[model samples]
Target: MEMLSTISGWIWNPLAYVALGIGVLFTLLTKGVQFRRFPDMIRHLRSGGATEGGLSSLQTLALSLSSRIGVGSIAGVATAVAAGGPGALVWMVITALLGSTCAYAESVLAQVYKRREHGEDRGGMPYYIKYGLKAPWLATIVAVATLIGYGFVFPGVQANNIASSAELAFGVDGQVVGVLIAVVLGVVVLGGTRRIVKVVEAIVPFLAVGYILSALVIIGMNITKVPDAVVLIVSSATGKDQVFGGIVGYAVAWGVRRAVFASATGLGEGTFVAAAATTTHPGKQGIIQAFSIYIDILLICTASGLLLVVTGAYNVKDPAGGFLVEHVPGAVAGPNFMQEAIDSSLPGWGAVFVAIAVAMFAFTSMVFFFYVAQTNLVFLLGERRSKVLEAVVKAGAPAIAFIGSSVTADAMWAAGDIGYGILGWLNMACVLLLTPVVRKVIRDYDRQRREGLDPHFDPGPLGIKGAEYWETQKEPVKEPDRV
Candidate 1:
């Protein structure tokens, strides 16, 4: 346990700084792409509905959101508050605000450099890391690292959380919950990206809305406390809180970590999602993905944070130890934190509702994590449409799930934290090198939009137009008609 904690600390501590720096840099370099494109993005994603062989922009966003809006939103908040203090919630909002821009840039770069393979369009950090940065070796390193993170460590953590929570809430055995989760995950993963997208599209909306409404009801029940909670968040964020005991720094780091974990900005994993889109223009898909960060971080995570703070469930001391803790016997710390908060105000069924919500939230994330691992594997092994790949993924999912349930939650979190830290450094390094290319793509898209031209026009081979990196790596000019 000590070793895992040390390992996780080593990974998370340094990478947090790097993630923050890269996030700030990209937010500045891109002229707030997240802010400018947010409204346009919302409309674009909604403009088309899902179609066969392809996800509509909204479906794509929903799928990505499903992966993000899980334990990270609930448990992550609890963890952050526990580690840092109530002030952490304030930092989370700031982190999400900045990190969402990074998400925009990376998603755009992924779209710009995306390629088609096996009758499907695919693109992500691997593409940009290899082709855009001309660093194939580094790209390969990141790909392998990411696969291990997703395939091995990440699922175990997800499973453990689910099992622990289920054991508490339902009196079901932990192993039973683990096996059930594994089976469900196996079914979703075997169905491939298209199937995953379909499932996410169906579930994400209902689940997210349900979670938010429940949270709002809790907040309304505690309506008188809302003003004080808001004041606490704002004051603590700015270091003006009366009970200042490292609260400012604690809040900032806590908030940032939760936002990063929830939205996955700079993680480079979400790009696989864009790779599966059916859009002619990768830019369109990228734009849609960028918007997902906002939905996940700004909306979902913030809602969870507010619920905890407003309800006074942000317990300062408990074994779970955070603003997101409660006194429920069978409740997992985070949801119980919120549950207890609600229960205090509403009584009786509050914990039950929160328990159900947490189960669904955690379950959705488990499926999403599997999809990330599957994509990384496909990238490394060369996309062979056979049962071999499917078999490996299927087997791995359940195995990881079983391991997850058996392990301690803290140990699982520590392991996941380590993986996420390595991923952040690798991903941010790539983003820094590719920022210019991302900028160029955005400029070109904006120009085309202004001039009433198709935004999907290939800008390469004509001196690689906007991006300096692409300018130097230009392929030989082909006949204009030879797309």
Candidate 2:
């Protein structure tokens, strides 16, 4: 317990405040671009656009949702509750609302400065950090951090979750489930973003809608307790509860941390998706991606939180005891609350639904993370040995999943906490320094849009020539031997 506390402290430490600070600062700098163009974003996504490279708006949305909905919704939310309590859900919503605006700015900046690689438009935090900011080294560092955090270690965690959920839901062996997930991931991701988009586009909408509807049904069934549940969540957050004492600060911080971690508004995943959008205006896609935070954190996470609260399951003590003793004792960890809610209505099926939802969401998240990692790997390693690096990273998932399945819930919760903490700090620093560039890009887009220029804002007005300003910083690369 002491080790868990220490680790949770390290991961959800005040330093994560830095990520929020930067995100808020960028949001302000962009002059509320997210809110201003919120409608235009929808129009663009539906209308579509002509781009030589990059993904359709639906594809971009699918990709971003794939990552956001995964472990963050399932394991991540549960983990936050375990560490900080139900009050943390409030912080998560607050962060998502604010952080998503910053998500828009950064992603738009990436889109404006995106480059063509192998017939596709490829850009992200690295593209903007390096080219837009004219800080090649900073871009390199940010890209490396993103590759490891989003792509490598993150995918392992997602895979672990999918395997665990499948085993719990369908009585499948963990190893067998892991292999199945890995095989599905390999098949889709190996085909690249085109295939990845198809797979996520097919699955994400149905899965998300299904989970939300199911939660609503459960909540409806327990409508009588709605007021009491809201009071508990709000009271816990405000420290009105005597049990919480004077630890309102702890609750507040935990909520903020969990929300940002869940939505991932500015943690580089949104930028990757924005860059992939086939659009005329970078800001348009940015706006669409920004809304994702709302859907993910505000809609999905909140529903899950409300479901847990409304059902009186959040207070359960032994989540692993299955649905029978579920959530009544108020456990210190895991989804005892949710498990109990499901158990109350569907008997044994509650666990099964959760397991299935977790498996689908987490599996897709693994695929999304691997793609992000592979993209950044190419950026850092150049086109030559990127394949080797990618293979190594993908291979690490099974081992991690195996370990995660065998471990206790407390340890898994702590590990995820530590990961969010470390990655948040590094990402926040990079995003803050490059914020001015985001501002410039947004201002430029606004100027263009006002002129009735079709909202086509390109950081590189002359294509590759605009990229040259930043290219001078990198050393010449020797050609690698080809087969």
Candidate 3:
């Protein structure tokens, strides 16, 4: 336990924080593509249903969001404030604004390098890393690591939180909930990606919109306190808020860490769905992914943070393992912060409501983990892969969730942190290496739109190769490959 905590802290504090600058650089280099394409992204959201054995663009978007908006947006936010204080919220907002560009780059690249697999469009960090960087070894490393980290470790965190929250809110047996979660998830997951996509397409919108509306109601009730909370967040971030002065450094680090954890901008998980989308242009799905970054951080993460901070249903713990301040006495932090925040506002039924909401939110994330694991297993096995390996992973995934019910919340979160930290760093490096390819995709996409033509990816005409699924029998158009 001690070792896990130490490793997780080391990765999140200095390593993840420095790596965040890469996203900021991407935002600047793209000249803020996320903002420029904002309206176009909204229009693209109309896409849905299955075709050509792949998820529709909108379903893919929901799949990506469902995978992202898990315990991180709820429990993870509370953990950040507990460790880093209110100032951390300010850094989270900053991370989202900048990280959108990084999200755009990776999502488009995934679409560009994707391959047709299992009669469906499927690709991810591994596909882009291998095809774009031409480093199959590194790609293999990432695939296996992702299979372990997300497939095993991160799902444990979500499961653990679900158990803990349900037990606290409704007096249900955490063990029973774990089994039920495993059974339900196994059913959906065994149905394959299509079923998962179909369900998440329904589940994501309901949970997200419902949570947003609940947040707005809480915020409206305490609307007058909103301004001061925002002010305090900014002040604490800049070291100008004397109340949180001593912890500004922790605030900045934890804020950015929590945002990365919640928004998943650089974690490479987004590519799983991005590569599976049936979109006309790779950049179109990329733009939609950019919007998801904002949705997770700007919308969900902030909602969780504001709900706690405005109501003073929050507490902070110093690194010395002592309370820095206690706004909510005896709250014990973590998911309890959000539960108590809602409970304080609405009383009796609040805890039960949040518990049900979290169960659905976390269940969606659990489903994604299995798909990711299966995807990587398929990648490692190539054509020689068998159902035996698939069955083993399928059983192992839910088993971890079951065991996680008995584990401590902090330990599970720490394990997940370590997984995401390593994967996020590796994926970011790969994106940086593939800069020219992403630049070319963007140039081609933008040129078509400017010419008043509907933009579609034509790698042959654009003089790019290694896009296995995108290749055509048509002759390549000779053009200088300059992006």
Candidate 4:
């Protein structure tokens, strides 16, 4: 456990700085597209309604948010607050604000280079890596990494939390819950992308809305303390608060760590789903994806963060052995922190209520996680399409879920962070190199819209090669005048 923490500390040591730099760079290069075009994102969301055979933009957004707005929104925020102090919420705001621009870059690239598979368009980091950079080897490496990281490592983290939370709140046996979850998850993934999207679209809003409303109620009850909470977040984030002034480094590092984990920004997760959506312009999906980041950080994560802070339901422990703010006596920190926050206002039922809600949120995430892994599994297996390999992955995912139930939470979290962190850097590097292409595509779309034309992608005009599908969007050549 100690070794894993030390290793993750090293990886995240510079990740915070690098992630911020990527966000800032894209924000400038895109001319702050996420902000100037914010209303446009909302407009695109309602416009791209998929046909009977296609995945709609909204469904894709739901699929991505199913995972992005899962356990991380609740436990991840609580974890950030516990480790980084109330100030962690401040970095989360910055990450979301700047990170949305980064999201637009990767998502637009995904749409531009998306591949058509089994009658559906699918794309992601691997797809763009192959198409944009023309690097098959690097693409394969990333595909395999996502398979291991999001597929196996992160699912374990979710299952571990589900099991622990259920046991604490309902006295349910963790193993039974794990086995049951695995069985259900297997049934859904075997149904493929359509089923996964269908399930998430129905469930994500219900889970998100209920959780947000609960947090809102708590915030309303403590309206007076909201100001102090906001002040603490800013001061501690900048290392100005006397209480957390000494831990500024910890605050920045952990804040970024949890923000990326919670929102999955810069990790190339959103790009895959953005690719699957049927849209007239790549910029449309890019804008839609940027908006989902807002929902994840500002709406969902902020709800949980505020509840924890406003109610004083968390404790901060310094590794050097002493209490920073011991609101809960002898608590080690986990889902219990947030549960206590709610319970402080509504005693007896808070733990169970949060447990159920986390279970729903984390369960949906696990389903989406499995879908992402299988998508990569298809990538790694190549275009040959082998039922044998597909079945193996299908069967293997649930088995791992059960196994994940038995693992310790600390190791599960550490393992997930390692996978998510490495992929984030690799994907960020790819998008950085392709920023020029992303820029031209957006300019093309914006110019067309400025002329009151419905936007459609035509990659040929920009001199970008290897856009096999999108290149065909251009008008056909007219052979010299007939005799």
Candidate achieving the largest lDDT: 4
Per-residue CA lDDT of candidate 3, range 194-278, in tens? 7877788889988999998998899899999999998888888888887788899889889989888887888888988888877
Query: What's the lDDT for candidate 3?
Result: 0.83
Q: lDDT by residue for model 1 over 41-150, one digit each (tens)?
A: 86566455443444567666777887788788887887776666667777777777777767777777776665555555566777777777888888788878877777
Number of clashing pairs per prediction, in order: 7, 11, 0, 0
After superposing all C-alphas onto the true structure, candidate 1 shows an RMSD in angstroms of 4.6
> In model 2, what lDDT does residue 309 have?
68
Taking the tens digit of each residue's C-alpha lDDT, what string does model 2 give over 1-483? 668768768666676576567657766777776678777767666767434555777678878888888767766676565545567777787688678876787676677667767677788878777776678897788788777666545665666665556655577776677566666666666686667667888999999999899989988988999888787777767778664424556556767776776777656677776876666556677788888887898888988888876765654222233322234654433444456668887799777788778878887777777678767876786545655776776665544555555555556656666666665665566667656566665776688778876665434442333443224325322212211
Write down the worst ten-residue block by lDDT for model 3: 474-483
Q: What lDDT does model 2 reach?
A: 0.68
Once all C-alphas are superposed, what RMSD does model 3 give against the true structure?
3.8
Q: lDDT ranking from best to worst?
A: 4, 3, 1, 2
Ranking by TM-score: 4, 3, 1, 2
lDDT of each: 0.70, 0.68, 0.83, 0.84
Report the candidate with higher lDDT, 2 versus 3.
Answer: 3
Off by over 4 Å in 2: 1-8, 49-52, 316-332, 383-387, 397-399, 448-453, 458-483
